[model samples]
Target: MSYDEQGYGNRDSGGRGDDAYSTLGGTRQTRTRLPEGDPGAPHGRRPARNTRSLVMAAGVVVLLVAAIAFANLGGGDNNKATDSGAPGSSRSDTTGGTAPTAPTGTDPVTGKIGSIASGFAHDEQGAQSAAANYAVALGSVGMFEKSKRDVILNAVIAPSQIEHFRSTLDEAYSAPFFKNVGLNEDGTTPSGFTFVSRTTPIGTKVTSSSAEVTTVEVWCTGLIGLAGEGSTKPVSDGWFTITMELSWIDGGWKAVTHSQKDGPAPVSGDTRASSADEIAGAVNGFGGFTYAR
Candidate 1:
C-alpha cells in the first residue's frame, strides 16, 4: 500500500498513536498565482473617484488591515504566560522588556557539534533558538542510523540523559519500524532509493525560562519516506510540535527532555504531488537551515 493510503504519517516511529517524541523522538514555499480575472466585473477601469472619497476608502482599508494583522499576531492575551502547558502559551516577557516588533531571526550560531549549530546565546532568545535547532537535529535523517544517531544525541541531549535517550530511541527505531518505512532492517536505504527525513521549524515560543533552564516549543513540519520510482512509501510531509526542556550545561543548552504532539497544523493546500524522482532530487539539491528565533 502507498504511504498515504496506509496513513503512516499519522503515527509515531513505533507505529503507535502516542506522543511521537515521548516515545523517544523527536518548509515550505507558497507559490502565488494571480487570479486571471474577475468574472463579474467589467475589464475597463471605472470612473475616477473624488479625492475625499478615495481618502476615506483608504483609511477604512488601513484600519481593516491593521485589525487583521493584530488578530493574527496574537495581539492581546493570546500568548500570555500561563501555568497550563498549552500549545501557544509562553512566558510573557517577550524580549526581556517589550515584545519584538518583528520576527526574531538572529545570525546563525557559529560553533558546531558536527554539522549541528551550537553555542547559542545565554538568554531567553537563545533558549528558544537552541530548542529550535535541537528539534531539527533530533528529527534529521541521521537519527535513523546508529552511529549518526549517537552523535546527534551527544550534541543535543543533556549529558545526564544521553544514555537514556540513546537506549530508548534504539528500541523505538527497531528493525520492524525501519521496514515499515521502506528502509532496510539495518536502518539503511536500499539501493536506488533515497530515504528522506528532514524537519523545518516554523516558529518557536518560550514556555518558561530561568537562569538555569528553559522550556520552549517548536512547531515543525517534516518530510519522510522512501523516494524512488514505484516506491510504496513515497515521501510525505507531516506537521508536529516538539517541546524541549533545555538546561544550561557545559556553557551550552542541551535537551533535558523532549516530547511531541501531532500538530497545530493548517489545512493542506491543493498542490499536486511530485513524482518520487522529483522529490528525491529536491531533497538532495536543497540544504537545510540552522533555525533561530
Candidate 2:
C-alpha cells in the first residue's frame, strides 16, 4: 500500500506502533506571511528574553552561597593574599577579556527547485546547505502526500536507494502510527484541526569530508502533530539531529543515506503555550524558508 495508493494500509503486517521510531529520526524561508516578520518562534528552557535575568539571578545566589561557605572555611589572610594575586595570573584571565574575531563570509547558494530549495554549490559547504534544506522537506507534513513525497525523495535521495527508502518509510508511517500521532489512517488531519510538521535547522556541522562524499550532522528543532483543542498531540516540539551522508552525483550532492537520534534538545521554555487555534493559525499562516550556509 502506498501513501497515495488507497489499498496499501490493507496489509496484514500490523503496524510498528510505538516501536516505529526505534528506527529513525531545516530552513525554511522568508516572511511574507507573518505580520510580525518572524518566520517562526523560539522558546528555550527559559524565555530567551529572560536569559539575562536568569543568569543574573543565578549569579547572585551563587555569590551569596559562596560568601557563606567562605566565611565558614576560615578567616583567611592567605586566601585574601591569594585572591589578590589570582587576577591577571592565569592566561585565561587576560585572554578571556578579549573577544576573538569571528569569521565572516558569504552564505551558501540558496534558491528553489519546484517547491523545495535547490541549486546548492559543489563543495563541503554546499553539501551541508543541501542537507539542511533536504531535511526540512523530508520532515515536513508535505511528505505525507505520495506525489510530494516522491518528488522530495527524487530530488534529495540517491536514485538507487529511492525504492528501498520509500518502502521502509511507508511502512514506518503506517496506519497505526498515524493513529497514534493523531493523524487519520491516511495521515491527514481530522476536521477542525490542521496537521503541522515543520523542521527548522539549529545548526549544521560536517562530520566527515571527501571530494565526492561527505557527512553532515544537522541539529534541528521540529514541531509536529495536529493543532486544535483537545488534540492529544497538540503541536509538540522536540530536538533532533539528522546525519546525512551525501555523494556528489551528477555535479550536485545527493543524499545516499540519513539517520536520526534524539537531541541535544534544550529545556522547554516558560513561554505560555499558545491555544490550539492559535497554533493552527501559525502553522498554516507562516511560511518556511530556503536555508543555506
Candidate 3:
C-alpha cells in the first residue's frame, strides 16, 4: 500500500490484501490482475494476426512522429513546457485561460480592517500561508515568548478578546504541556530537537460578513511534534476546523473568538514516511503567507 500526495492509500503501491490497508483502517483484499495470455487462446485458432500487428506498428509510428513534432514545435524543454501550466504558475490560466479580475467597491470598515489585514493578506493561492502563520501565532509558541506573543495576540485577535485570549493561553502553556510536546518549560525547542507546530489550511470560507464583523471558517490540517533524533513522538499531522469570529475594529479584522473541532479527516495512507531531518528542512525552508478571502 502506498499513500498519494492527497494522503489516501493506493493499493497499487504493492502489498498483500491480507494486510490491513492503512487508509481504509481495515483488512481488505487486494484486487488481482489476470495473467497475460493470447486473446484467441480460447478460440479454435488465431485469425489475421499479421494484419493486427501491422496496424499496431503503424499506430506506434504515428504516435512517435506526433510526439517528436510536438517536442520540436514547443520551443523549450519538454519538461518545462509541461510544467508551464502547472497549478503554481501565476500566469497559467487554468480556469479556462481567463485571468480573474479584481473585486470592486470595498467596504469602508472592511477596508480599514483590510489595511491591517494586509499583514495577513493573501489571495486564494495564499490561504495555506495565512493559515500556517496564523496558527503559529495562535499556538503555544506565540504564548510563551513575552514580546513576540504580545505582538501576535494584539495583531491577530479582536481588541475586546485580547485580554481573555492572553490570560487563557498563558495558563494553557504551562510547564507540563510544554514538556509533553518535547519543548522546554518555557516553550523553547529542546536540545537537538526542533519543535514543530504549524497549521496548513486546506480551504477557507467567509460564512457571513456584516459591516462590523466577519465570520470566517478555515479548514486546516496541521503538523505537530518535534523533529529530531531520539524522539519518540515524531511529527504527525492532524485535521481541525477553526472557526473565527472576526471584528472590524481599530483598522483591522481582529479575532474576537475562535474555536476548533477535529476532522473531516481522511484515512491514513501507505506513503513512505519522511525522516525528521527532511521534515525539519522542509519546514525551515518554506515561508508562510497571510490569507484573505
lDDT of 3 by residue, 1-293 (tens): 00010111122322112221111000011111124446567733223345434533433332232122111111111111113234443222344542332443433222322212334332222322233334434543334466666676666655655665555445544566556556677767878877665555566655444444444455666555678867655666545455554545554445544444445567544356688888778867875433343
For model 1, the superposed segments whose C-alpha errors exceed 4 Å read: 1-92, 95-107
Which residue pairs come into collision in candidate 1?
none
Top lDDT model: 1
Off by over 4 Å in 2: 1-111
Candidate-wise lDDT, in order: 0.57, 0.53, 0.42
Best by TM-score: 1
Q: Which one wins by TM-score: 1 or 3?
A: 1
Please state the error at residue 179 of candidate 2 in Å.
Answer: 1.6
Ranking by lDDT: 1, 2, 3
Error of 3 at 172 (Å): 0.9
Q: What would the TM-scores of all predictions be?
A: 0.68, 0.64, 0.55
- Worst ten in a row by lDDT for model 3: 1-10
Models, CA RMSD each: 14.8, 18.7, 20.6
Q: What TM value does model 3 have? A: 0.55
Q: Output the TM-score of candidate 1.
A: 0.68
